[model samples]
Each structure stands twice: as C-alpha cells, then as structure tokens.
Target: MVEAVMLWNEPNNLSHWDFKIDPDWKKFAEMAIAAGKAIRSVNPELPIVLGGISPIDPNFIQLMGSHGILNAVDVVAIHGFPLDWNHWNVNEWPAKVDEIRAVTKLPVWISEVGASSFGAEEVQLFGLQRMSELLLGNVERIHWYSLFDLPASWTATTRHKEAEGSAYYRHYYMGLLREDETPKMAAAEFPEGLGICQWFHYEDHRLDSAVEWLHRLKVRYLRTGVSWADSHRENAELWFDRQMKALEPFNTTLTLCFTPEHLGIAPHYTSPPKDPNTFAEFAQWAVSRYAPAPVRTNSAYAMPEEMAAPSVLR
Candidate 1:
C-alpha cells in the first residue's frame, strides 16, 4: 500500500519543455482536482498531494484554491529552490512556505528542494543546510532534488533538445554525489529526517555503493521511479528484481513513482497515457512486483478513471 501520491512535480515550471498548449493555472488546478478525487476513491486512506509548484509561488496556490483544488487534496506542495532561477536569497524561503500555508490552510510539503553545484560544492552545501534549518518546522517534509548527478552522456541522451541551450544544463550537477558516486559536501551535511530523490536508472553494480552512501547520510526516505517503458522492454522483470534486491538491505521507506510514456505527448516522458486502462494495468503490475510498503505515482494529467480503476488498487 502506497502511503501518499503526488499528482505531479513542479507543474508551474514548464520552461524546460515546449508544450502544445499554453500552460495556464486554471487547467492545472482542474487536472489536479480530478486526479486527487480519483486517487482518493481508489485508496481512501492514502494521502493525495498537490504537486509542488516551483520558485516558491504562493499566488499559484491561491489560483489553484480558487478552482477548489484545496478541497481536492490533503496536502499543498512547493519546490524550495532558493538558489536557482534568479532566487539567490535564502532568507525568503520560510515566508514563502508560510504564505502558501495561509492560502491553502493545509499541511505544506517542500517536495523538491535543493541547490545545484553550479558555482562551488561548499556553497551548495551551505545553502542546503540553511534551507533545511529554516524549513525544519515550517513544512511537513523536505525532499532533496537528487542523490547522484546525471552522467553527462545520460543527460545528453535523455534531456529534450531545447534543454541543451538553456541553464538547464546545470541540473547535471545537482546531485549530492557526482556521476562517479563519490559524495559531495551536501551529502554529508544533509539534514536528518529529510528525504532524497534519486534517479532510478543506476547500473546493477552501482547499487551497493549507492546504498552505502545513503546509509552514511542516514537517509530514511527514498523517492525513485518505475518507468512503464523500461518495464515493457526485454528482461524487464529481471532488471527490477536486481534493483529491488539491492535496495532491500537499506530498509529505507520507498516512494516509487509511476512514469508511463505516451508517444504523441511532447517532451516524451511528461505526457499522460492515451489509454487509461493500459496505464492502470501497468500500474497494477508495478505495485504487485515491488509491493513497496508505500508507492507514489506521479502525473498531473492522470484521468480520474485511470486512478480509480480496480486494476490500480489490486
């Protein structure tokens, strides 16, 4: 049984992709409400989280609330990126979380928060520590953006072409560790009780080292993904078995995200499934295979039927 489900991640920050429609708040709120209702119907006890909007925008929460999004979900989430996107001042984060809480009158979560090592590792470490201290009591949870930096080759291959020319390139170094799996200063200084977001595509041999590092950091919660495309590929079950085996020793709570690919959707991975039944079936298989004590699927575009399908709960 999954503990909580976040509908999407950073929906307000669509600058990284080229979307077919104008990314408006109204549409986003409507989608969130529908997805929340569906998730609640399937697992009445599970928490339904509104995806974090980026750059600490309180007005977005207000806009979503106006559309009844506040009533649809149990938690309001926000990304705490105090260093990037011209938000250099770290002092503003507490007030930002407070602002959102005031509007939504719900538990606030800093779902995606981290400072990239764009300038210096020490600077990134300092910013991360300060942000954690400030956010300690203000929010329900804080998940660091990443655990390992994306390998340059992996970034080049996976990122959309438009991302190549922008500041998005800096994301390659956002992890607490470099691509080679060595720890950075931020890894050592990561506050206790906070969660981390790690990429799910690590090689088999690398899992032990990754777990070792996570153990050293005293990490308790791990947010990772299960890709629909990967599951359908050759030898998929074998691959998942290995990953799960590697992860078992750590005994960390898992938040497994479901990411199904839809062909016609722009930017590849961000699109919702055209066939809800197929997506629900795939989600069921993933849940049964991992049987993660708590699973979390990500998407703002998930249809209500897709979430409520009997296949998803079984």
Candidate 2:
C-alpha cells in the first residue's frame, strides 16, 4: 500500500525545455488528474500530491484550480528559495501559503526549500535558519531540497555547458555536505529536534557509509530510487530481495521513485513513459515484489510485513 504520490515536479520552472515548449496549464492539469486517478485506482487510500511549483506562484495554483487540478490532488506542494530567486522573499511565505490555501483549500507542503553555499557558507547557513523560522507553522511539512552536493563532474554530464553560468548552477552546492562530503555550516545550523528527511540519488546506493550516516543524522524518511533498468535485468528479483533485506535495519520510510529508461518518451530517465500500459505492468510487478506478502505465487519474491506499507511508490 502506497501512502502518497507526488506527480511531476517544479512545473513552473520554464528553464527545463519540456516546460518551456509545452507550458499549457490545461494539458498539465489533465495529466495530473489522469495520473492521480490511475494511482488511486491501484490504491484508493493513497494521497495524491501535485508537484511543488517553484517560487510558490499562487497565480499558477489558481490556474490549476480553474482547470480542476485542485480537485484531483489531496495536497498542494510548493518549492521556494528566497536567497537565490529574486521573485520570492522569506517575509512573504505566509502570505503565499494563504494565497495557495484560498485557491486549493488543501494541505500545503513546502516540499523543496534550500539555500546554496555558492562559496558563501555563512550566508547559506543564515538563509537556512531564516527559512526554517519562517516556515515552522506555515505549512504541513518542509522537506529541505537535498542531503548531499553534486560532484563537479556531474554537471558536465547532466547539464549543458551554458548552465555553468546560470542561476541554476547553484544547485551543485545546495547540499548539507560539501562536494567532498565535509559538513557545511548549514548542517550545524539545522534546527534542533526538528524531523528531517533526505533525498538519496540511485547512484549513491553503492556507498558503504550512506545508510550509517543517515542513521546518525536521525533521518526519519528517505526518498530513493527503484531503477526500472535494474529491475528488468535477469535475476533482478533476487537482487532486490537482498537489497531490501539489507535496508530493513535502517528503519526509515522509503519513497521509491521509478524512472524507466527503456519506456521513457525521451531518452532521459525523468521523461514520461511512451506507453502507460507498459509502465503499469512494470509497476504491478514492482509492487508485487516489494509489497509485504510472503511469496504470493512467486516463490522468489517476498517482503517482510514490516517492510510493506512504509515503502511508497512515487
């Protein structure tokens, strides 16, 4: 059983080519509705969430509401960065929450909020402090943008050379740790006793110390990947069984993200599936393998009862 689903992400950021070319709110609303319906069909109790809109644009939320997107989702999520983006201000967050609430009347989550060091660790620390203070009671939850910084080499492969000079370049330094895995000032500045969650990229799964470090940090939840390319390979079920067994000791809720490379409309992992039915078939297989039911028809697949409901499909 999945708890919740967040459909799409940062739809308001037009820098991504897909949003720039197909910036149709109606089409986006339709897609969100269809995705929500499909998820609910699989697990009716699951809560469907609209992806965080960057900069907390209430006008966009109102537009989504006009197209019935608000009715389809159980929650509205927004992303904010007061220090990097001139369009947003820390002082204005409460009003932005009010604006969104007035339109959607749904629980709002600040799903991605963070500051980048950009060679100024002190400023980043101060920004995080202020962001936390401002958002304390304004939203249901605040999922800070990330847990680790991207390696410099990652930019060369994942982004265009021209992006090196853009505002988006700051993302490479947004993590609690520096690229070398050293703690930054922001890590020390994180508020005491507040629940924190981290996003772990699939590539980092092989790191020996990742889980231990997360446990030390008292992380309650982890948003990680379930790669379709890996699962479709031969003996994939055995591999996943071992992996899940290994992860059981950490005792963290897992939001398993699926990115099917072969089925994607574009070559990129984030692209939508070319055929929804194909993706659905893959999802069923994944659920049956990962859900907490001991060998349901397939003797090779089994998830401990403790592992079932805590793993959400996203």
Candidate 3:
C-alpha cells in the first residue's frame, strides 16, 4: 500500500529544479502547494510530503514556510549524502535533522541519504553502518538512496557535467547492487525495516529485481517516483501500472514530480510548469486512480431499506 505521496523530488537542487528561473523558489512553492492540496482532495488521510530538499538548507525551508507551503503538506523531508556529496562529517546527521525541525512542527523525514562506492565498496559498507547509527531513530523515515546502481549508459542529473566530475560518477555507485545485479558488501548487512529510495524510469527493466531485493531485505518502506514528464511516452500507463503493482506489497511513498518538456516554462524537466494546475490535476488523477479514499456512508444518509424495515402500507 502507498503510505504517502511526495510532491516532488529535490526542488532546491540544480539537478532536479532549475533554480536560475525561480531564484526565490516562489514558483516551485506555488506548484508544490497546488499538488499537495490536490493529493489531499483525493485522499484526505494520505500524508503529503514536500519534496525532499537537497543540501539541507534551513533558509529554503523558512522560505517555503513563509509562502504557507508548510500548511499544504503533512511532512517536510530532506536529502543528504555526507560521504559522497555533502561537505560535513557523517556524524552531523542528527544535527541536520534538528536544523529542519527547528523551523517547523511537522514531522521531518530523511527522504534520501546514501554513500557511494565510487572509489571502493568499503566506503559504502562503512557509510551504511555509520548512517544507521546516526539516523535510524532520529528521523521519521530514512530511505537510503537506491537498491541498484544507475546504468553507465544513462547520464546523472546535473547542470554542469564537466564541473561535477567525481560527483557525477558517484550517482551510479550509490546503490546496494551493481548495474549487473551483483550485491555489494553493504547489501548483506543492510539494516532491517529501513526504507530504500529506488526510482524506476518509464519501463525500467530493474523493477522485478528491485522488488526481489526489497523482499529479501524485509524492507517495510519504499520511496519511489512517477514522473510527470514520462506520462507523455507511449505505453507509459502500462509501465506505471506494472511498476505500482510490483511494489504494492511494500509501504510506499510515491513521489509525483518532473514537468513534461512541453509543459515546462523552459524546455527542461527542471523548469517550472507553465500552469501549476496541470501538475495539480495530474497529482489528483494519480491519487484518485491509484489510492482513492475509502467510502463511508453516513447513517443519516442511508437508504430506508438500510436503516429499518419499510412498512407495507407505505
């Protein structure tokens, strides 16, 4: 069952959001608020999560809060990669959680956090252990970056491919399994009950293998995405149905994100949509189709037959 729905991915990061066009994040905030409200309209009980912000910036959180974005969603999430991308030491995980918590009363979740085996598998092994120690009980949820390494054929999402050099390569090795489906050292001793962050592209071949691995790990929670951009592809609904069905066993957090190229103000996926309502309508349709609110008929509105026996004379 899908336990929650996230508005987007890392809206503050350059790779996921084109901040140059929306320097103040006002547009992103507007889009998120619309998406959150739409999700709630479908299933009021469903938890709506703000896209996990990358770099753990408190100022950005404050900005979202100022726009009343906080009121539209149930939880605030963040993404961090101390070993691979973050500048701070790994031990500061709790402090980072505190920083987000200080700004809002809503629950804080570590939507994505991981270490990459770019240089050595041992780095990922140690990262898993240390991350568990620091973050296991500190946050509401911790979804380790991925279950499978990104294929070498695909490019990592980044604005500057040349400047990102090592950081760009690290994206491929953040998974517990290699691109060939071989397990890394860290996969064997992975902590139980923790969430995993594994995004499946439209018709991605790794969906079955990822499900097997999640079951093997006794994972209870999963954080994945359904891209609005990919909705335009032929047979996209077929892939979406298959992916969601395959993952239905786990408690999932489905992130609805990415602007369709034509819908974007600019031609990029990171560009804000020309109409925020389009994104909201998509979110509403997804939730209503996939996870609708349960129906409950009130006694006052019950039919006469359902309430009591009808008189023959009547």
- Clash count, one per candidate: 2, 0, 0
Instruction: Give lDDT tens digits, candidate 2, residues 36-103.
Output: 55554445455666777875778888888888988887888887777775486677777877878877
What's the TM-score of every candidate structure? 0.75, 0.74, 0.94
Considering summed lDDT, which 10 consecutive residues are worst modelled in model 1?
305-314
Cα deviation at 102, candidate 2, in Å, is 2.0
Model 1 quality (TM-score): 0.75
| CA error at residue 92 for candidate 1, angstroms | 0.8
Q: Judge candidate 2 at residue 130 and give its lDDT.
A: 83
Compared with the true structure, what per-residue lDDT tens digits does model 3 show for residues 88-193? 9999989999998999999999999999999999999999999998888787789998899999998777888757888888988999999999999999989975
- Cα TM-score of candidate 2: 0.74
The CA lDDT of each predicted structure is: 0.63, 0.60, 0.87
Over 259-298, each residue of candidate 1 has an lDDT whose tens digit, in order, gives 3444314435444444434443554444444442233456
Q: List the residue pairs that clash in candidate 3.
A: none
Please provide the root mean square deviation of candidate 3 (C-alpha atoms, Å).
Answer: 6.9
Model 2 residue 174 CA deviation in Å? 0.7
lDDT of 2: 0.60
C-alpha root-mean-square deviation, each candidate: 6.4, 5.8, 6.9
Off by over 4 Å in 3: 299-314
